[model samples]
Target: KDFKSEEEKREYMLYLDGSNSWILKPLNFIYNLNDKAFFLNSDHTFEDAGTTIEIIRRAFENSKNIRKSDVNSKAILIKEFVDEKNAKKIKEEKEKYLKLSAKFSCNDLHLELKNEDCQKFSKDSIMQLIMIYAQYKTYGKFNSVYEAVDMREYEFGRTECVRPLSVEAVDFVKLLDKFEDKQEIQDALEIANNEHKNRIKSAKKAQGVDRHLFGLKQMIQKADDKTKKDALEFFNSMGYEKLSQNFISTTCTGTLDFIGYLLFTPVVWEGLGVTYLKTNDEVIYLISYHEKQKENAKNFAKYLNEGVEKFKKIYS
Candidate 1:
């Protein structure tokens, strides 16, 4: 059944207040009558994307061929895996002043590139190149880049941030903008890819700079007043400001068979959030941006496609 109007759709969906207390509990199944879509909403405080995906897969397997009425009766019990005290601490640490904003719009792009074009490079490297080039073409300059790195190999771990804009990456994107020689661009790409791989390795080992600095800042809050003041001053410096902007936030979920797409709002109003899934022959991306922002998701997707085509020619 379709919703008669937007108001009816909102009335049918589960609405939460500003507190978002409902998110603290178990999973929530929200159905949108307008799009006839179902969404599983979970808090990041409890489960990360990897665990959530596994839960969804299990629920899907259990519900296969089952009656619609019986589906609700099938309970998927998750264990008490999260440490309560730690979870509470994490939740408390996240409390901040709220500034409301308008909703962001997203565009989805599914592109199929010839395997040979990307065969020489890692999927992640290629994606990173395409993203950097797209950003340059869209905004005419480089910005801080963030790629989510899963840290679940460690106990009670969630994710760490990998800043992908290395000196080599910057050089490569510059060369890309200038239409440099194919050999020069290819060499720069390899160097950038290597740097990206190193960053991923460091983040996976929980040695990334972001989390360590975050933890240090949290510790500073409990330090002596003078120490805390000094630390806060440095944290508020322009150097830190630029690092924290994260104008290009991207995450690649790899080729998850169950996931058709992923969407997330940009961390900043003027930034872009990109989530991509790469399969054997195709790469699918969901690019999100605030409507008020100068950059358009549709236009960014166009630049991304152009970058892909450029890569095809370079490799050929």
Candidate 2:
């Protein structure tokens, strides 16, 4: 507003200290004289020194601010400008292909459509492929978003030759069914041997186990009349007291649950000079001798029956 002469503006620009101005550099408005030469010859040349620099600086600043404001606005504008109904166009383009075997190529869609790779496909195959892609994309909500553009590639008369197998067909066979023909008995033996070894190791190392230690003595001392009466009845039923009297006390120190031991640990009898007899799928101990030693066999038979009857009463 203070500028009153043509000389004022020329000297103002020509001698302006903008070259030393830090503010002008950041705004990209710092003007060398040669670049500002055209403006020097223009009609509004009578502007003041500080005022002209401030005005030019403000113009650049306003332009930068305007651009910053327009970033989001321009993006929305471009999106709004696109045809929202381009799904139909996309579908029409894809409808030309009968097979989509490879990954989609954006570089040569036109050439791909022009090629003879596509052949006639069944409508059912196309429908199946459509469902596959729809299910893949929508994660099972194909019923709603089926008409979207992203799914248009599915309607292209294309079919995937590979179809997923059913759950029953894929998962029905048990492991035993597959492996039994090869090594069923070997696998069973392996498992049984491992269990036996673990049990033997645990029993040998069970130093402080107190659950069943002194169990018989504890029960006898704590017995009510009913328990004492039950014990007497069991002895009477088996004549167990009379039978045990015949076997020396030193040989039969441990009262064994002989039936349980026989059932679960049949291997124990193999070392005791007795052969196991299988009759009606039940195991019975037999003493077999080829030398006609009938006395030894008879003694073994009595001992076996005595042990069996004693175990039956105890376990029962």
Candidate 3:
């Protein structure tokens, strides 16, 4: 072994070529160390991926005292008995969410609303109103809209759910145009605030319109053929559910005060993504669509800024 010099041992290895490799065995589990990557399971439901993760975290990690036995149970929130009415509603909403799948892209917007302005107009309600306004200004109308609700306040199972708010937002936007005075603006804000609060209350108790509708869908699915057919027919007749995205989904996420650098990237390598995150001093809005829709996303950012500034001036 010592017959040749050290230089001769390396003679066959010229330039340390990385061109050759051989596999001796395979491994079962996979490990990924790349921080730049994100993922969404192909089998997941149509709910926004970011919201889904936050929901799981709240139900399991945040709430330490949740009942382990109720892990997989569904709520009988409204009309415990399954009927044609409930099935139709669920099918209609579910169909709307599924049919409106767009492309994948992303944009981050940084903005600040002072504490004083937030007192007069609720942040959630105002942000929601602004979205509707921007959509109307751009697309003229949106048949259906989505608002993700947190249902963790109730003493239920560990699995969390979101309430899909089906509202006449286009009609509401029309009403906004008729407001000529401060009284009218105040009235509008009041009504929107009330609706927002009511949605949250209903969602917490499991009586949320969407959650109940979901329960109904499950019940009707287990029923006879005639029932299922009837529900489908009724759902199809509703034009609102059929109309795809003139609008998109929205949600508000929490942030830390001390952490200077933070990343809340969720995997949406294929479709759309949107999330609202806030620290003590600022709010960051992230919206994403497919690469081809970059122009639309850019315009939306402009619309959002204009909407916010206008709202600020209206009641100022």
Instruction: Name the candidate that leads on lDDT.
Output: 1
Of 1 and 3, which scores higher on lDDT?
1
How big is the RMSD of model 2?
A: 44.5
Tens-place lDDT digits, model 2, residues 99-185: 220111100000011112112322222122222232222222111111000111334311111211112212211211233332442
Clash numbers, per candidate: 0, 0, 4
Q: Please, what is the TM-score per model?
A: 0.77, 0.17, 0.59
132-203: candidate 3 lDDT, tens digit per residue: 666566555552445566654456522223322235334445556554676666666666666766666666
In terms of TM-score, how similar is model 1 to the real structure?
Answer: 0.77
Model 2 clashes, total count: 0
Q: lDDT of candidate 3?
A: 0.50
lDDT of 1 by residue, 1-316 (tens): 4767643333222222224333335566655565876656555566656776677788789878788775575656655555898778655643421223234456678888756668667788788888888887888777888888888778978899888877888898888767669899888888888888888888888789987887787799899999999999988888877776789888876666665555556878788988887777778777777767635566689888888778777767
- Sort order, lDDT high to low: 1, 3, 2
Local lDDT at 54 for model 3: 57
Top candidate (TM-score): 1
Instruction: In model 2, state the lDDT of residue 106.
Output: 9
Runs with alpha carbons beyond 4 Å of true place in candidate 3: 1-103, 154-172, 175-180, 239-247, 257-272, 278-281
